[model samples]
Target: TISYDCDTYGNPIEAYYAETFTPKVALYDGDTFIKYIDSNFVVWEDLRRIDYSYGLNLKTAGCNRKPDNNWDSLAKILNPLTYWTNVYSKDCYSGAYSLSSSESSLPFPIMNSSNVNGLSWRGSEDGHYFFTLLVIDPDFSYCTLKTQFSVSITGVPLLVSTQFLIVLSTTLAFILVLAATYFFHPSKRKIKPL
Candidate 1:
């Protein structure tokens, strides 16, 4: 590995070390849960430790589905992406519902801090999502490590879909019409005059 002492072009220097390093990356869930990561997938469970990420589904009980044609090839869907946030806090990751930016320069950064801050995931309401980590080289050049991961959440939706709303509205309207007709019918009127 080489280091530029003062600045990008300050003092060109080289150093050799006995330790060996392979280009690799790992996620830290603070031991509160387990995660699976590889060339094709990155999954974590029981990560409720990330408090704010509730709706995003870091640890869903039992939600799963097979990928469909709607999803592009895994390579295209997961690779070459980046995300960032200046408002990162303890539970912010779990609070995120979707990616806000599309630029590829802001990959998720792993820090020495207890929290691996600045990455957000799409909430489980939509199913599978694209996740990416930046593989930074000692020399500063980097590429994105990408994967497709799903969250299985047995939780129920806060609101039903549009189709459900439409059906329910129609049913209520029909019932209202029947009740109004029954009450207004001339044959059913009963009046007593003194």
Candidate 2:
């Protein structure tokens, strides 16, 4: 009988075993416990078992149009045995902007390896973007996980000179006054000099 505690670091746990032997596996959450066993009674010479936990946490820095070389710091893998394979990103609204190494297309240069080293956005517009990370376990081909995160890019504010503002305000005021006089004021009749 193997006993395992689920309160370790608050990560989800998964157990895998070879199909050679039928073993009773029990899951306990809080005070409730559930038990299940394989219906087939088969015995084999080789049997293997493994237990692991999996989770992901992601964070991004301030909204800016630049490359962040600290991509590894921004993402945290709860499982140490797993490593990321690919990182993908696309615009949140139009999906016109996309970046990935597999696609061999990127707006800006990014470190594309087993780990996310860096990321950059050279979009023409400022908006929200989504990133998807693919994690996989080398020992288990079937074990793969995908996590997503979002980032916002804020472009620099458009600048307007003080003189331009003053001129625009004056022009608008004059136009308003002319409109009021033509629409609201009563017309006056003038006599011609003979």
Candidate 3:
């Protein structure tokens, strides 16, 4: 269990004791884990869209282990949480920009919700984008949790469309016919002494 002691009058005899809970946070893409290019980077193809989601892997431990049907109510009453997302063009933690002033322009709109499910985003330009998912315990801001990740949007070669493929196949067949006729003509092939 999580125990906290508070002394208001600088006297041990008047100390207050209480129990608290801590929440967990994890980033997800629908039901699957987010695909990462590396430990902290993700790759997004040009013109491709992706949906982001998250999960709270809160386990029963400490002061969180409450009786059935009471855990949710108690947690909500005790730990009113807040969730938000941030996007950045550069790494603020590495001093590329100040954390307070480094928020980048969002390419797509994000819903204001705790779950973040069905939040769709499409990468239109090729660049490096950083994202953060933050959860704050309103009662104790110091207990906030955050997950940071980066996405690198890269350009992909254009694919030949169906029309292009048909045209290419017709041209190749015509060339093959010309080559066969020139190579296998009776006049071009000399007859051996039969």
Q: Rate the local accuracy (lDDT) of all candidates.
A: 0.31, 0.32, 0.32
Q: What are the clash counts of all predictions, listed in order?
A: 6, 0, 0
Off by over 4 Å in 1: 1-113, 116-118, 121-125, 130-148, 152-171, 174-194
> lDDT for model 2, on a 0 to 1 scale?
0.32
Please provide, for model 3 over 88-127, each residue's C-alpha lDDT reduced to its tens digit, 9 standing for 90 to 100.
2122223233211112221212112332222222333343
Shift in Å, residue 74, candidate 2: 26
State the weakest 10-residue window (summed lDDT) of model 3: 13-22
Q: Write the residue-wise lDDT of candidate 2 on 63-140 in tens digits.
A: 123232233333343222222322222212242334233322212212223222233333333434333333332332
lDDT of 3 at 32: 83
> Which residue pairs show backbone clashes in model 2?
none
* Tens digit of per-residue lDDT, candidate 1, span 32-137: 5343332222222212223212222222211132212211233234332321221111232343344323321222223312323322333433222222333322
Error of 1 at 59 (Å): 28
TM-score: the better of candidates 2 and 3 = 3
